[model samples]
Target: MSRTPPARFTRPRIALLAAGALVAGAAGTAAAANPDTRENAAAAPGCTVDYKVQNQWDTGFTTAVTVTNTGDPAGSWQVEWSFAGNQKITQGWNTQISQSGTAVTAKNVSYNGSLGTGASASFGFNASYSGTNAIPTVFKLNGVTCTTGPGGPGGPTDPPDPTDPPAGARVDNPYQGAKVYVNPEWAAKARSEPGGSRIAGQPTGVWLDRIAAINGVNGGMGLRAHLDEALRQKSDGELVVQLVVYNLPGRDCAALASNGELGPTEIDRYKTAYIDPIAEILADEKYSGLRIVTTVEIDSLPNLVTNTGGRPTATPQCDTMKANGNYVKGVGYALNKLGDVPNVYNYVDAGHHGWIGWDDNFGPSADLFKQAATAEGATVNDVHGFITNTANYSALKEDHFKVTDTVAGKSVRESKWVDWNRYVDELSFAQAFRDKLVSVGFDSGIGMLIDTSRNGWGGTARPTQPGPTTNVDTYVNGGRYDRRIHVGNWCNQSGAGLGERPQTAPASGIDAYVWVKPPGESDGASKEIPNDEGKGFDRMCDPTYEGNPRNGFNMSGALPNAPLSGHWFSAQFQELMKNAYPPLP
Candidate 1:
């Protein structure tokens, strides 16, 4: 996506009357006092403010403020206040805060900008003061004055409905008991195709692959438009809107065909132009009720592990990303900003077992994930979970043989197809990797999403049972469900098929089996055709080009005559339907 100018911030002075005093204590210890709560009176066509001293010490204190719009809905909002004492803010979260003299402005970030009527947004800051930390007598929303008085609309006394999920709060499994939004645009295309109606109604991810995609690319639906559609489809029940947060500076650095518009060093542009805007839209109050699951930066972090640091498969691009640290920074920034929206769940893309299930790649990739998750002011908590096999054709389960299977005194790992990788399929890899991620400090409750979109391997070639124990190589190759030349041949693979339909909690540690990669989208052009999307031609996408070390020097195995990455490929779609694992009836 082309970079756009940074968004200009508007500062409007509004005021609310809030009064409080902080008790002094020892230099390092918190003061002994109950938390202080301050409220603002109702203002017609205005707002209310709830300011509280959450914690305090002898020289430092933290404060939380909630602003509720009692008037008409606002597309974006800002809350401003002043410090009566010498308290100076050290840092803040959940809002973009800036201080000037005694005045402070807490502006909404991308996600929290929308404030519907009676909707409340909260932010907090830590400050240091030599004297008493006095709550300012005034608070403001936009330019309106909030008077010091009793609680008004959406006030402390007016409790929220117990049955409703708290504004921005996350559920254990968003897909559970919720309807996933079916993209009308994709559905329309599917319905236009013969026999496409069978899976046309299924939910697939909306790829925000560029900055242009946020607003709408070439007059297509934008992020807000999709959310609005999701709301309309929600009825009274919960709904999940899947989003592929795929744009990063120098994205997909290990390969071509998916190179991003931003150069390797353009991390700042990535923040200001790409991630920030998307965060703003997701934070908008108009879409708060919808469960938004963001698949963050596919094909990124895994490259840092398997394709960098002088590895045989290493590319200069991957080396550049590792050296510049932009990949980690970009992913971290995306997680930190996007995670602030309570209802948005972030699932970082973990490459499939074929790429990183080897002993050398597995643990290191998890560590790298931790590094990215914690970078740029992000904590592990920012990540809701991890997704595997996104946009790749990795079989969800190799039911014919196990990784532990041995044939003629040889383990399955000895087979050329298995290549000593510890996993036989995406499901086993995802489940095992979840434990590894938790071992490295992620929350244990974290779930895994398996992209079963094109990994079905269910055409006439799909093996129904284990092959004869002739030899390890012959047995493994004959019975393996993934029909690609090699696991690493990851473009528009020939004979690839649709995998599992979208479902929830299909197995242990699995949150959902999702079609995160929409069927019918080409992985890349079959040849050198190119345009302005910053996508380049990769030989791996070519039908006959010899492979690199990444794909074991095998034939490309890609279908012939494809389009650029993300463009529709009609022949590939028809092939996917013809080979759909469960067989479209």
Candidate 2:
């Protein structure tokens, strides 16, 4: 059989920085809270503005409130309110507000104090509460009850002993049109400093990921993970991140595989690793505006194609990848439960539908979509929809389905590889996938993303003695897609020709595009012609591939197979981030 290279994948460039990032347009985001709403809540009896939060399961409330006002008259304006005896304000915003079961106290905040009736300010905080919790009854201002009027639309009203706030106090989700990302420790490190600079964190900006490690609640990509940083870093828009949870206990790559471990069990791990992180991060006040969405195979498909667990039984055979029910259980769990996360969302893998052929019906993919949502009892937010641009005015592709003998001869044996010149055609394939995804039942407006991680073909990128020979700057095989589409691990025996990171979604008319995989990482295990050994970073460059001293994870600097060499890989990351988002301001 012709060993045609596999297609590549990508995600928004992960934030890799040497110094901390201010995030893109972070300054504009600090004004996240609406001054008007804060003022609305401030008008109460006794400037002792007390607040309570609800709508939670056991141990799941992280809401708090603060009161502030414009520079008006009135020296001492106290704000106070009475709770129904259920929820408590764990933390205060601009004041030292305290909650003791039902009774609460809202004192003047030292720095942010003084309502003056109109200075244009508000207070917020986080808390942990749950079950049948309601808003306070009476709100007093200046020690004397102001007798708050009927709470208007999007406002809460005070009723006699009213346990709950008025029915119209709920706020809509503000995470629409945002992207979030997740990754493992290696990817995590890459994200912190893409391209030598820290990616900024602004409200409504993206969180490029490094790896998608779905392990456990604490270790998982749950709310507790990066939420606080997202919230504290910026205060506006939505904390949009591209989440790519790649911990399928047993996964398979290179076309198709029956490896079910990477299937359901891996998915279960996703719930804990990926899903739970959102909840954990949301637990912080900063994540109030953060919206998280998973990036499909966001990072290197090492788990899919390269087996860290063991050698593959064979390609296209899913026996190794069939560890779990397609990791469907985990994915289902996340889909059903994502709605509960403060600013969380999802996108099920809608593999480049073009791979299935242009005429394929989006509706027929229903089984996959349905399993993602209802099966796991999750609030399936969206789907990957279309991955390839198989057919389009541009006709794009991420794989080198058409390779030249010259490029192949530089590597291992003779195999039909992807065509670089024709790869961009994959984008056309992606568009078709998009239409099919929409037909299946994705949110009409929920945006989708494309990964430009790699181009699939092994890189003989730069002529080196022991690596895949040739070219100085050809995109790691024209993009990570090359090494991935139909290849094995460690295609980086030398370099992936590392494409300059993309700026946003393919300027080629994509909803959103990002670097799902951390640049400079290993593809697991592979055999390049010239290198004639493992070319992946984790394995090939481990000094173990050619029985050389490439060192283990500690290997640093530019060497063979080490796609993640500290300085060298960091430079690649720098480029990817540059392409993902503009430099942090």
Candidate 3:
């Protein structure tokens, strides 16, 4: 609803012509209309014009100017705004309108020509003005005056309902008995675990709770720390410590050209950022009962544009932490830390099967993510399987927007940009990913984490809420439930219902979900839009795939300072925090 000024004038003669017509028909209509209708009409001789302006939030405005149809036909009118003062219009739209030194005018749009007595057609403009004054009154619509609509920024109202609600919301879950995971800060300074709920962070059993398991032995800080917290506060082991991780160096496939040849110190940076963390986790004795994971985002490495084949494209590209990249070296590095990384499962993203129906692109992305995880040192237990439809996965289960379309091809468009399909058939595609993992020698304990974040009705389409409900039982583990994926609004604005973890995956293998990214923080935008080509809006954008895709780019106010501060992101996180763990019971 970001409105720009009218692109030139769609028409400038509307008001003038209608003004003359009104003068001619004024007397005639005065005698013809019903007595009551005329009685209620303005009891004036000359037309009184009321002009106003506004810019409504999210949607455009309706410059409702009551064009008193002082004539007949109820059509043809010209509206003009002569900026008598220094006021100016920056931009506008929706009419054959034009402007001169001070006047901005709008003619009746071609389709509808007339406005009978009392009838009026509303037209408006989204403009930027200067000096402290509204438009002058000399401007008229067909010389006939009219009443104005409410004026102000989008007409004196609260801002549009942003995606997130500022104060924490009561997103009461429909699934009462399910396990769930709250954010990191909530886990850190917990007063106590709620009754009947198990903590999902670290299981006190063996791998994750004690300081040794997470710190001394297995060293990674982000998730290992989160896992540990989940374990320490579990009152009844009922809390489903959900976490999500989509760490793509560059959202696209062509992130790194020649690891050794390109940058000055890629490997060292990789170890410091990605590898060293996994190494830390390996040496921990507390690696036993935690739901930690190394999820591989398919087609998610922003830099790997040409590397589109499958696991092979991602497999060979090693994360030479010994060098200087800021991420953990590829799977090989993590694998080197095995034994200690136990119970930590991995999920390769299977770009939703919606792509399968389109061209089978996502499957390979999933395969590559797994391949990379395996290369990094993740085992069958740590990197068990894959998941799809995470955030805008082009899946059919769009619980958010009810993704259906007028396009006759499939139920929806492939995607707004790429030709890849966006609608995923959850059951069929889940089975596909499951079968793929199973076929890949993953016999006993392997399954996929169907990102239930955007799923709703199975078919057709409608306004689906209840955010995203999961179905772990039907697809895997006789339904014991495992990890699932979802979003908590990286920008951290309020309204996004984040902590409602599903109650399905309650076993050892199918680990609980985790929020890998610090919500409110950005993964980065892709190199698509003008300001965003070549480089990423964030590190997680996979133009060819779901690089933690953004539903829309909402530039609220000023930008944040750095990647660390993530100003907006933090604000949103604070809002989410307020919601998930409000002060009251």
Report the number of the highest-lDDT candidate: 1
* TM-scores, each model vs. reference: 0.72, 0.43, 0.40
Q: What TM-score should be assigned to candidate 2?
A: 0.43
Query: Residue by residue across 1-585, what tens digits does model 2's lDDT show?
Result: 111111112233222111011122211111112223464455322222223221122443323333333223464445566656555555543456777667766665554343455332233333445565555546554455433233421134433533222221211211212223323444445446633223221112132222232233335443345554445533543335545443444433432211222333344455565556644554355554555555433211222323223442233333344344554554455444554453444555544422333232234444455555555555334332323311001112433323232443342112222222212244554554455455656544334444545432223432222223343124234433333323222223222333312223322225444444445443332322222221122333333343222122232222333332211354444433343211111
Q: Which of candidates 1 and 3 is the stronger one according to lDDT?
A: 1
lDDT of each: 0.80, 0.36, 0.35
Report the lDDT tens digits of candidate 3 across residue range 1-585. Answer: 111111111111122211111001001111112223466564332233433332111222113233445454444677665655554443333356677877777777775466655554544333334454444544455754433333311234536645322221111110112233344443332213331112222111111211122343323345566656656644342333333332333222333210121132343443355445654653366644333444443334322322332433333343332122323244334334432343344455554443343334444444444454444444444444555555422222233322343233432233332224433355455555565565554434455454433232122122223222232212221211111122212222223323322222212222222233333332243222232122323323322333322322323212232232211234333333333310111
Tally clashes: model 2.
189
Least well predicted 10-residue stretch by lDDT in candidate 1: 23-32
Report the lDDT tens digits of candidate 1 across residue range 1-585: 111211212122121111111111111111111112345533346667756554454566656566777776888788777788898887676688999999998888886688887777766566778777777756677766666543443345656755444444577667655667889999888777887766676789999999899999988999999999988888765788999998788899877998888888999999999999998998898888988899999999999888888888999899989999999999999998988886788899999999999999999999999999889988887887899999999898888899999999999999989999999999889999999999999988788889988998887899988887899988888889999889889999889899866656656778888888889999999888859889998999888899899888999899999999999888888989999875554
Residue 227, candidate 1: alpha-carbon lDDT: 94
**lDDT, model 3:** 0.35
The clash count for each model shown is: 7, 189, 144
Ranking by lDDT: 1, 2, 3
Superposed model 3: Cα runs more than 4 Å off: 1-228, 235-265, 268-277, 286-291, 294-329, 335-340, 349-357, 366-370, 373-382, 389-422, 425-428, 451-500, 506-585
